[model samples]
Target: MKNKTYVLVIIALITLSFSSMAQRVDRTNFKAGVHAGVPFGDISDLANFEIGLDLGYHWALSELIDAGLSTGFMNVFVNNDTVDFGSFVLEGDFPNIQYLPVAAALRIYPTYDFKLGADVGYAVGVNQGNSGGLYIRPMVGVNVGRSTEVNISYVKISDDYDFSMAALGILFLF
Candidate 1:
């Protein structure tokens, strides 16, 4: 009888501990960051680099998962290249390409401080004649304190022209 009672107490304690841990993580959070990107593929031929800012809000779905909304602005700087305008050759610096991306974000935590995340949505063009369309980003990050993280990600925007970049950033959580 004493052995059975001890086992039951141990089971109760374990259950309570799990419940407390779940409660601790089921909360809302906001994160913001800035990133610098290196262009790749065809984009590299036209754009030298990219810089961006991101903001997001997340609702904890479980201890290991979160769903959120994210929005950001990215600017791709044009390279100095000459474009043949058919009648003449146009040279000098071109206008920078800009995008405003809005996305649905999801994050999964495999460990306490490590996470994998993805965002999918649309990037709206800010410049006339610049077409923007689908936007996607996949990232991996490690949390460095209660409210800070460092991340590396790949971002893609597909439209009349497609662009891809590798980005590294820091995020602050609140």
Candidate 2:
């Protein structure tokens, strides 16, 4: 009898929880954004800066959680036509390191105006002779107004080598 009573209590609590969670209905949304930043760490020696466009579709998993798919294009510009490696200098054109990121994204809204998020997936090398690698980004964001958001993020990709950058981005939701 005690075991059955405990089971009944658990089910009652769960039902109440779901009913409260269901009070707020959220709709699917689209996000588009752009960002620019300078290359840092290992790739800094080979590249100057990067700019990218972000596109994503998100569905509300709960009142405060969003799950989505994210994709973006990034181009890291070559530093110079000539590169110096301390002991030697070579002169010629070098290709910019360019890649596209395809990732699973999740964001949590701690408050109506604040959010934290992350993306993990693969970066596909789109530049000639470039093979892409794993992609990861963690971000913090602020809601600017009704339909705009501003965010700062760290971008990292590891292939045969690890490359990273710091970016500030803005988005318009539709």
Candidate 3:
């Protein structure tokens, strides 16, 4: 919990600095943009799909360099098996194990509409059973419009328990 707070603070500070410097950039050459993406992944034996939404603030650090703060909620579902009270077996779906991830990533643009990035962040699970997990994802994104993008990544959490796929449907700058 404390770690999550600190990461958010750091991202906030960086964003503030970027916002202040954005006006000074050449308006025609560089611009900042906002993006939102939905990321999907698979959890181990628990759920078929793990999905999340990301909201990011991006700055064109350079033509080839970009940095941003990404925050989002991820839902991880699992199956729970319990025995019935002197009866047949009982099973049902349960609420998702949720996560809040705050991350910073560097994106490199290889072409006008293609981008690749690597991200590192702290994932704090919002469930009591799962305290939290830390993870890293390397992704590929394609710009579909001035305000939209799509991306995919492979993500893994520490302790080697879960490895999953992450797909993002994004809204962002051109």
- What lDDT does the true structure give each of the candidates? 0.87, 0.87, 0.62
Best by TM-score: 2
What residue pairs are clashing in model 1?
A: none
| Of candidates 3 and 1, the better by TM-score | 1
Q: lDDT by residue for model 1 over 91-167, one digit each (tens)?
A: 88788989999999999989869999999999999977787999999999998887888999999889775588999
Give a tens-digit lDDT track for model 3, residues 71-172.
677676555644243445446755666777778777887875888887678878787766666767788888776556677776655523454555545544
Q: Specify the poorest-scoring 10-residue window by lDDT in model 2.
A: 19-28
TM-score, predicted candidate 1 vs. hidden true structure = 0.81
**Model 3 misplacement above 4 A:** 1-42, 80-94
Off by over 4 Å in 2: 1-28, 85-90
lDDT of 1: 0.87
Q: Which ten residues in a row have the lowest lDDT in candidate 1?
A: 20-29
Task: Look at candidate 2 and tell me the lDDT of residue 93.
Answer: 85
Question: Local error of candidate 1 at 88, Å?
Answer: 12
Backbone atom clashes (below 3 Å) for every candidate: 0, 0, 1
